[model samples]
Target chain A: MTLPKTRWRRRSAARPDEILDAALTAFIEAGFDAARMDDIAARAGISKAGVYLYFGSKEALLRALIDREIAPIATLLAGFAETGGADPEGTLHLMATVAIERLSDPRFFAVPRLIIAISGRFPDIADYYRTEIVERAIAALSSLIAKGVAQGVFRPVDPVLAVRAVVGPVLFAALWRHVLRGDTDVPPARVIEGQIDLLLNGLKP
Target chain B: MTLPKTRWRRRSAARPDEILDAALTAFIEAGFDAARMDDIAARAGISKAGVYLYFGSKEALLRALIDREIAPIATLLAGFAETGGADPEGTLHLMATVAIERLSDPRFFAVPRLIIAISGRFPDIADYYRTEIVERAIAALSSLIAKGVAQGVFRPVDPVLAVRAVVGPVLFAALWRHVLRGDTDVPPARVIEGQIDLLLNGLKP
Candidate 1:
């Protein structure tokens, strides 16, 4: 029973993640329009039928990438809420750190890159990305800023713009990594923290 | 003499510009790899020979786009130098304004988009954009920030990161306009101005 249970747990944990890793490579190499599931399965060391067992189609694979890679955005926001009341600014700082850390991770960077790369050709992909990921993250950051303004801890500023100000540099860093990566001397963390520092100091009344 | 000279001047001015516009459309539709010179020439209402007269090859056409479209970047820096001594902060503010205006122009928007879109597949294009445009702009912004910090106009900060902090948001906004068009409620001007305002305020001692 113990041996069988171990085998089952390992299989469940590894299979889906392996397929996703393969999918990122395929998508980046050939793009969404040209990436094939059969090729993805081959790269993942699985049969086409096995890939289908996990993801119904190429679209589902993309959605799962969003769900799995980007799920951190909502989770981080919710987690911060429990302790957010203790210190409004602290909550923002933590969120900034998390955003830079998560966004700059190469494993998850593909999702945003894929969305931006195809954005010009496919309006629907951009819309879905905004609805599923970007807008939700913006809403969470906006609410955090609004709370600060309401409590009189931070100066009155446009929360939406402030959220954009905070998040934009890190987002830009993430995209720039894939675009002009070797050209930049500034490390990802430095770019994120430097941008956040200036913005945070400016936020103080 | 006047009639012949006028006819020649109009043809010379219009033909190159028309070819560049058609090149932009072709690049966006098919990317750098698949885009054909013949197709671009057809779109521009010219013969392939006409295009080759102005541009030697496909690579030369792209280089011409960079020269014609992105040349403003360096020129703007030179324009700011005359008044930079009188007002360093204002210099940056004006540059920010110019950046937003220039980048948002649809004709120019496609240049950066084409650069970013194929950055992974074509490293040289990204390098060309970074070296030719980004580095020059950063140098101008960095010098301005250094002068401000030295002259007691701004709080001391890492000048490189400061320049990046200033440029990153507006650049992001320009890119965002194309990627998430029709979805944003905040006007483009507001997004760029708000982010700039926060950073400017933060720069104060």
Candidate 2:
């Protein structure tokens, strides 16, 4: 097959990131199944063979994308969980703030959207995402909440349920902003701060 | 075109509901753009013409399904908001319970899932859902929260963010149960109650 002219461009350290970026755009625009490697290569300014050299298959690219984009967040959450035991509330606020900032960006939010959209057709992708990104994040958050409970700063609530409370609004905000394309008059940071305040302080006068 | 053998069944008052049920299944199984009217009719035990007679197009069928399945819930929420001024906390509890109960069901949750999946490809569908279902629900819930604040039962939180707090966990639960297919160790009602308690009481000792 004839290679695109841009394929002659020299490879650099940023090749993987460029390819993944292109893959994300292709997947979002054309869907995972319909997105072709040729298009992804062209978008990345590489040859199809170069794309394949980096990612053996489309699924591998997705997995790498998840790792590249979401895994670091999960790792950061874990780091916070470990370091935040002495001050869970403050750590939780920091965590939520970071999460809201990241998710508010449509490019960062696209992975979960892609997973949610295609999960029914590809259970394995859903399973991978749940295990790799979602479950790890929940586990880290749960540990932080559990630390708060242990310290007697917070009430004894089930960590699982508490994690949901912590994550739900953040997730919803992302969905509202990205998926539904709702207009957000309030800045994302402000919205998240409000949510965190409500969680920590309750609605009682 | 030859009609499917099952098309001869007599039309009943339930025909519309049947067609909608079939349409939902078809749409979920095959992405909205890929789902065929012929398959929907066959699934509903009606002819293609019969399907078209009731619904002019696939988009129409989707709209009708949303009305049939989700509109009443919005109406119910509005009713609660109207009557809930006297007891905002109690009414909020009742509302969350109702939402959790309905969303826990996969069949009931499918519409939102479908919308989230296809909104990128079909902006009009997304807009229709936002205006018809999500916005209405948020408005009703926000009004209820405002009543709570007016009565001093709730702190003066911004009704918009407050609505997100109220909705986030419940929506997350549905996504957890249906999309990720997470195993629910705690029952949904209990989970919702825990979240509501966390919201109203805060996490403090």
Give me the candidate number with maximum DockQ.
2
lDDT of 1 at B94: 82
* Candidate 1 lDDT tens digits, B52-118: 8887888777878988888777667756854585688677778888788787787787777766656
Q: Which runs in model 2 stand beyond 4 Å of their true positions?
A: A1-16, A33-38, A46-57, B1-16, B46-56
Chain A TM per candidate, in order of listing: 0.80, 0.89
Encode model 2's per-residue lDDT on A1-205: one tens digit a residue: 9867763667678899999999999877766666789999999987899998888888888888888888899889888889988999999998888898999877788788878777777688788888888898899899999989999999998888788888999999888877788998889778878888888888887
Residue A155 alpha-carbon offset, candidate 2, angstroms: 1.7
Over B73-180, each residue of candidate 2 has an lDDT whose tens digit, in order, gives: 989998998998899988888899899999987777878887777677678988988998899989999998998898888999998878888899999988887778
Instruction: Please provide, for model 1 over A153-179, each residue's C-alpha lDDT reduced to its tens digit, 9 standing for 90 to 100.
Output: 767888876776777677666656667
lDDT value, residue B185 of candidate 1: 68
> What is the lDDT for B109 in model 2?
86
Output DockQ, candidate 2: 0.66
